[model samples]
Target: MKKLKMWLPFVTLLFMLAGTLTLQAQRKQGVTLEGYVYEMDEDQKFPVPYASVSIASLSIAVTTDENGHYVINNLPARNLQVTARFLGLEEQTQEVDLSKQQVLDFVLLVSNFRLEEIVVTAESNKAGAATASKINKTAMEHMQLTSLADVMSLLPGAATVKSDLTSVTTASIRGGSSLGTAILMDGAPISNNANMQIMSSAIGGSTPSTSGTTPSIGVDLRTITTDNIESIEVIRGVPSVEYGDITAGAIIVNSKTGRQPLTIKFNTNPNLYQGTATHGVNLGKNAGSLNYSGDYSYSVSDPREGYDYYRRVTARIGYSNTIGKWYTNTSVSFLSALDKAEPNPDDEQDVTIKRQNDLGIRANTKGTFTFNRNFFKSLEYNVQFAYTDRDSYFYDEATNATVAYSLSKQDGAVLSSIQGNKIYDVNGNLVTNVPAGEESFIAWTLPSQYQYDYTVDGRELNTFAKVKANFAGDLGATHHRMVIGADFKSDGNVGEGKIFDPLNPPYRSVSYSDATQRERSYKDIPFVNQFGLYAEENFDWEFANRHLQISAGIRYDHVLNFGGGLSPRVNASIDILPEALTLNAAF
Candidate 1:
């Protein structure tokens, strides 16, 4: 009986397989629609390929392809009901009368709730992926109370992280230095000081420091309160045309839209000597959002590191609105910092004492064309502009210019200024080019920079469009799900630089300031740009009953100046026990 038990089950399974195929074959008839199944809505004018589609009462079914189009050459002449499904979207159904040759199409609306599909679980934003690895720095609300530098540390590949008492923090991303990846906030490009990893001032002037001096800090990621954020998406490799330059990958950060009711909050961090308050509210029947926030901190360095000190303040005010098919966002911000550079007694051979202060403002705007329910993914266009003014004066044991536009008694280096005692001789006045002489004394020394030392003022405008996917598909589903998009970025910059002419008063002096004075002028770059196209796919499979997952994707990047190339990514994961104990690997 025991032998018969095992043998019987095996015999039964073979017959079941034979029966299943025979039934499937019988259900298919000549001159019938035998391709994959699909569901579409008015927003999408094509098949929802790779999506599950099957007859509600029968086993007759097939999945769609990369084109969102399906092809089935045979099916019986009978009335049938088919169901279709895609993740994060609603399911759909269609009824067909096979008696008469026919073709049917469907459009599925977004289901109000998606989380309802899975229950009783520890939820994390970083869902397991089959191909390529990803780190979702998707923080919200209280998460913003921290710095961007602090947030990046939570990723698996970025295990090495350090933060001083200040806001600046640094980490390693996928074995690469922190500088390897590009960082952007609300469409604004962020750059860290070449020496430390803290953010530069918002206006390109004296930006505040988050931590102590080292690694020349970049922008402090922690300051952008997650409350005002709408979404944060980062893709590793798998480069897309929509994002170019800075090769590793791209991180897309978008702010919140005021579609909900008013919200207000206050936050304080004693560790960094900071306190902040933020407010957000929607207006009019359209429910546009208006948000504002401010923060200030005073930081004192550890005696062991140095007597360095930092004080900083920053704020943001913005509005968001949607009109018909167009949506727009605008904001203005202020950032300032005062740093103390105690006298360098060690270099006293040329002993130097210095202190610098910087203040500036930045403004930004974005507009987009959107299709709420369209299938080709919503289309978007964006534009932005900014201006910055930051100036500073230096005083050494040598000199200080107390006058406006005067080159006298100043650390020398001026472009447009005058000084006294025009030395003269020769025929009547000095004949040689040296305005000043034992040597015609035309002027002394000018400030090394009239626009304030090391300042950057920028103005830029950019526009681009991209396609997005609204759903996720299974790995072994024998279907092609992808992201297809393209975009372009156009930007330019202009600012002032200091020049010295010893023959002219201001700059002639070895003195630091305009003992006399010289010349200064503004400079600008006409434009810089990026453009390209991208697409990717995830493969599905079933191996040894262990939910196998795999994904492979590639993209083509095209730069006008350097041309184009392709990048590929492969990833896989195995289930030790269904959903738990997952062993994932990627390259």
Candidate 2:
């Protein structure tokens, strides 16, 4: 009987243990995943189709449908890793515990350059190359950039200054003038070195560039609005040979393409108002896609106060497609802008008076082609046509415009004698008057009273074409990447200025006061053609399974107008504890 009781207790314990395990297994929860994948288009978000979704733990995978909806069932009740990937977008991963059904959404973005967390020591296009800084669309939205000039101030080693009188915005980099810094949209350069002004006797040579009294240089960014910019990159380090005419640095802008959804946005503040709309449509696998965008912005220093404001309107359309190993992208855009400024009545003066009514229009077409299985890697071409018309004049609100003076005597003398007030001409000559109270009399201090209007017209055309090829091979134990490219560019400008002359006497306006001012003009049209050929070779050797890396590159460039030169760059990285610590140097 003693033996039977001992055995019975052991059997009962085993049964209970088995029953507990069965109940636990039955109580385990199931995992089901349901969510959508979205792609961002400026300020709007829309679902994406055919995104690959996979779970590593369960060995299950699926693709999102046309509506960007995905559902996966029958996953284990444990922590699982899920990965989502799409072409032309950054891959994303998520962690989910299958203890219950989980709902998760993913957003994907596109970028021209990708870095997986590496410190840059030298100039390169790859990860950890040079001092390249990128401003993505998300960052652009957060910063609320109003114009291209605002972007320069955000970059390192660059300073921006705005002219309060002329409403011109320019930038200087690393103590260098704006002329040395190159601004490029896409792969082409658009530099404006001309300062349009009425080059005639009535206005004299009062243009910012030609006048010793004012400070304004290079292209004016105040007229460019930030509606269609997808991203911007600033290369602060030694740039590649592909970029030329730049002594300081370069700014590259990439416009939005057609791989996005439709979006609309409205933004406003006390001094600024903006509206934008963008849309994209997929035609077919063989036909490609279409994209369109429109943006308008109106900015004022103070809406309730003085006349200091500008308006910009821009529109863009693009098409992109891929067939076999060939991919093509083509786009066209137009810009219209106006900048105006009026000085306060008290601060207005004939010698230093500046009131600008600037108007401009620009149109450009750009096309790019990439070949995946060819000796030539890519080809790009751009054509730009633009015109600027300005009607700026010095105005005197204090004087009436109905005055008609006799041609025999100077207007200042006649007016002074009629008003019975002693007035001085621009030369400080004293005058005495006998009559009093004339309605049409204007003081000699009013500059606008002597001239009709100052007008300037400018037209510019630019074209760029380039071809690039890359080679990758092995040299001993080191890997070599070589890039070779050639580019040709032409820039031409034609403009006419009226009523401005710099060589005239100091008292020129007053000297001709007795005669009706006849407009004197000048024309200066400059044309420049630049051809460039460049080659770069990069060699990388690694030790200890990539724990230590040494990279070096040398570049040679031949510029048709600026001559030729050679630039060499070197970089190294040592991983101390894998992802935890890294030591790097570049020169």
Q: Which candidate achieves the best lDDT against the true structure?
A: 2
TM for every model, in the order presented, reads 0.51, 0.61
Model 2 poorest 10 in a row by lDDT? 206-215
lDDT of 1 by residue, 505-578 (tens): 22123322222322333333244555654444443455566765454444456656756665555556668987
lDDT of 2 by residue, 1-587 (tens): 45445445533543453344334433442457789988776877788775667653222456676677877654445556688765445557888766653888888765333354322222243422445676656555555666777776666545443312124676566667787777887666766644445334433222222211111466666655566676677766555556666667677787765456567788777777888888777775446677788888777777664466666777788776544334455676676665555555565463333454545555555554433111122344555555554545442222232323331223344544244456687999865432344444433443333333234444445566666654333333444344556777666545554543321212233333343333333345456666765555444555565555444444444545656555555556677777678776766
Which residue pairs does candidate 2 place in steric collision? Answer: 122-130, 198-498, 199-497, 199-498, 199-500, 200-499, 200-500, 204-500, 204-501
Each candidate: what lDDT? 0.44, 0.55
Candidate number of the best TM-score: 2
TM match of model 2 to true structure: 0.61
| Segments in model 1 whose C-alpha atoms lie over 4 Å from true places | 1-146, 156-171, 186-227, 230-242, 249-254, 259-271, 302-308, 320-334, 337-375, 386-477, 498-526, 538-587
